[model samples]
Target: MKQVEEILKRNHLSVTDSRQKIMQFFLNSKGALAHADIEKKTGENFDRVTVYRTLQSFVEKGIIHLIPTKDNSIKYALCKDDCEAGHHHDNHVHFICDECSKTICLDDVTVPQVKLPKGFTPQHAEMVVNGICGDCK
Candidate 1:
């Protein structure tokens, strides 16, 4: 809990009970989390709308990054410490285990650079690999 508070302070975000609980959830998660996951983990203590707003705030604060799955359901994962306000360097690939349906951040594998046509500017990119995870295999 203290660590979560410090993280919020470091990120220039005010520490709130909801934020702390939500941040702690992210810190303890082994992989990306969806809205339902969060709500289930938090139980009946937090309202659904509050959880959604908290996630939105975390994403805007760069405390978390969005992971888009093949089914179009988005998940959230903790961002690296270097990520700052309006800037996120989590360019690594996301791995979704087919067996367990878990989405993990592949920090060691970075996304390849792409050269765009003239007059085009790239803002962000995402790469996700689906396969059987080591635990499943």
Candidate 2:
């Protein structure tokens, strides 16, 4: 509860039931989740618009990040320690299991720096390695 409050306060968002519930869901999640996944797990009582707006708020606040998938489905994941207001540097590799469609943060693997062509500036990088997760194997 205290953590939730602090997160909301830092993001300059007012605390609400939906926000708190979303925060708790993120905390309990083992990996990244799709919007539909969240709606399914939380139950039907949760409004779709409410969840969408809540997620948008979280993204803007840097509490989480939007990861784009090859299939065009956007996934949300918790931000790492390097994240800050309006900007985030995850610096961690992500593992996406093709079998289970699970997106897990591989904390042990830090993202390696890449050399870009001159006159190019890099902000953040999203590296996801797709394979069969241990549980699915």
Candidate 3:
């Protein structure tokens, strides 16, 4: 709860039950979770619209990041180690398990620094590797 307050204060957002609950859920989760998966697992009475709106707010605040699956479903994950409230660190790869549709942050396998041609600027990058995870294998 104190951590949530600190996070909210740093992000310029007010601490609320819904927001705290949402953040705690992610912190407790083993990996990334889709919106639908969260709703199912939380067993809370929050409507889908509420969840979506909360997720949107969190993403906009840079407290979480949006990761899209190959099938186009959007998953939400906690920010990277260096991520702050208003700024994001999106230079990491995501690993998606083909068997269970689970997504894990491959922080250890960060994208290698790339050398782009001159006059090019890279704002962000993401790589998705699809395979069977250990739990599913």
lDDT at 115, model 3 = 89
What stretches of model 2 exceed 4 Å from their correct place? 80-88, 117-121
Candidates' RMSD to native:
2.7, 2.9, 2.8
- Cα lDDT tens digits for candidate 3, 1-137: 47767777787777877777877788778789888876888867677887898889878878788786768889998855623444647468888888987888886777777889999999776788999999986
lDDT of 3 at 59: 84
Please give the range of 10 consecutive residues that has the lowest summed lDDT in model 2.
81-90
TM for candidate 1 is: 0.85
- Between candidates 2 and 3, the one scoring higher on lDDT is 2
Rank by lDDT, descending?
1, 2, 3
Note the clash tally of each candidate. Answer: 0, 0, 0
lDDT of 1 by residue, 1-137 (tens): 47888778877888998888888888777888999999897654888898999999888877788888779898998855433333556599999999999899887788988999999999878899999999998
How are the candidates ranked when ordered by TM-score, highest leading?
1, 3, 2
Judge candidate 1 at residue 118 and give its lDDT: 100
lDDT against the true structure, per candidate, is 0.83, 0.80, 0.79
Q: Which residue pairs show collisions in model 3?
A: none
TM-score for candidate 3:
0.83
Q: Assess candidate 3 and give its lDDT.
A: 0.79
